[model samples]
Target: MANGLTVKQQRFVDFYIETGNATGAARKAGYKKPNPQGSENLAKPSIKAAIDARLKEIEDARVADAREVMIFLTSALRGELKEEVVVVEGEGEGVSSARTLQKQIGAHDRLDAAKQLAKRYGLDGDGELLKLQKEKLKAEVNEMKTAPSDALHINFTFDRRPKDGH
Candidate 1:
């Protein structure tokens, strides 16, 4: 009914949105036999438009802007978020005190998140992060090219001793 789609087409859209799999959505929407053309059905212009509109609506409803993502990463980097912990009680009287352990989000993860945020904000350079990286790599290559040739030269020799029997 919506977007000029038939009831089945609308159901297909709903299923596709919920399951995020075209073939599965087709099967769930009452396609009894093998539908090798299921993806092709989804590719129809009307169906595609309906799906895109639904996705846009969903994305708009769940609003997490780049600023929010950056703030969360900053908070994580600052250790402002509480770490999860688990406690286990021992069964025996002689057992040690109950053990407690905090969950760990590795430093590498935090650093990588921070780096992604930095790249998104263009803090690293004019272009995107990959472009900046390419530029940096080019600069390093140029530096290596211009460096003294003597630095590249290495002289070494191996000394072989005569055999004991000889």
Candidate 2:
């Protein structure tokens, strides 16, 4: 009546003041549910007790943090870890034309795959198709030499495997 809080109410009020979370303080203070009457809810002393408990926990945590900061400051005063640090600033462009170059490079790789398939079909060493393939290979090599370094890597492995031991 004098203040909104009795001595007991003041304790709960103090808890909420410290923790800043009524629900958490309530659970911490071991409050399960309010009494059956709606009037016996958060407006009640029991609920305030729970809130007070949570506030204590928050205060304890803040105290711990303050202690850690003090320790760290003391250590720094004693002179530890003075290594030089370098931080690079970002230029902010992502993947600059990389995909375009990759596709161009991939085209050359596809050509090489076709060449392999041609050989497997026995078309490259005998038919008119074989003559066309040789011309294509020459053009590809010339194009590759002129292209940027990020362009495809072309590798050819010659057969050392013996003909089907017939």
Candidate 3:
């Protein structure tokens, strides 16, 4: 019925989509010889085309692409996303009531989003470079503090005789 496939063939495709196992899908679709039938069905051009079209449709409907992922990461970084957590009230006794509380997303989650955003724009290296520069500057300052002054020059003359004959 679907894509010119027979009813059993369409059922096989549907089961294949759900289970991702060809022989299992064939069995579920009531095939007596599931292993060979599954392989035979997969070898059909029309069935493969149908499966490809349906898979593409499913992916387009469900999977998040780059743009969607970027949007999510940006929203998470900006704190625009929120979630509701159910808090259960119970001390040492038994249990009381549960309350649903609305709050901003977790800090670690936001930080991870920020890190991912930074990595996308190649900003993750800035922190490392800045830290290295700070360390180098500190080492230079320490060296300057312990270094001898250039103005304090020392000259050695081994002449012990006076200018006029002693």
Candidate 4:
């Protein structure tokens, strides 16, 4: 046993992290009764700590930190990311030799990424610009609501008449 945990316990921790299923991990670890031992093992301090540490290690390796996120956002804003697009140079031909060319990402996507980066990095004029823009839009909407409708209005008044025309 390593670190005071049995071999099966270590295996269980490994499988648990991989499968994310306690009972399945226990079964894979060769536990006789996985149903009960699966959850019970997690309650053990050593196993829990080992699992937590391993998970942290995996996250540290697989997950990106704030700096990485910022870098990615910057790259997206700069349109450095590319997408595969099929361009047909010769129309009316069934299969034309088309070459994929690297082009800047669409303005819409780049603008979206830029907006997020701006908000995240305090580049939106300390939120004051956004707030003012929002206020301006709201005022425009209010003005539109109060503006006279150009829709044509028609009213018809009919006098009540008896069936006998009396």
Best by TM-score: 4
The true-versus-predicted C-alpha distance at residue 26 of model 4, in Å, is 2.2
Tell me the TM-score of model 4. Answer: 0.58
For residues 28-137, could you state the per-residue lDDT of candidate 3 as single tens digits? 99999999999999999998998998999998989998899999999998889999999988866685888999899988999999999887775788866877899999
By summed lDDT, the worst window of 10 consecutive residues in model 3 runs over: 145-154
Give the alpha carbon lDDT tens digit for every residue of 114-151 in model 2. Answer: 55555555666565677788899999898988999998
Model 2 regions more than 4 Å off = 1-39, 63-67, 81-86, 89-166
User: lDDT of model 4 at residue 8?
Assistant: 93
The alpha-carbon deviation from the true structure for residue 20 of candidate 1, after best TM-score superposition, in angstroms, is: 6.7
Give lDDT tens digits, candidate 1, residues 1-166. Answer: 5479887778888998998888888888876642664687677999999999999999977988777888888877665655666676777886755565765556876777677777776776554667878999999788878989876654798758666744
lDDT of 3: 0.89
Q: Give candidate 1 regions above 4 Å deviation.
A: 17-27, 30-40, 53-65, 77-79, 86-94, 97-166
Q: Per-residue lDDT for 40 in model 2?
A: 47
Q: Report the error of model 2 at residue 144, Å.
A: 99
Q: What are the clash counts of all predictions, listed in order?
A: 0, 3, 0, 0
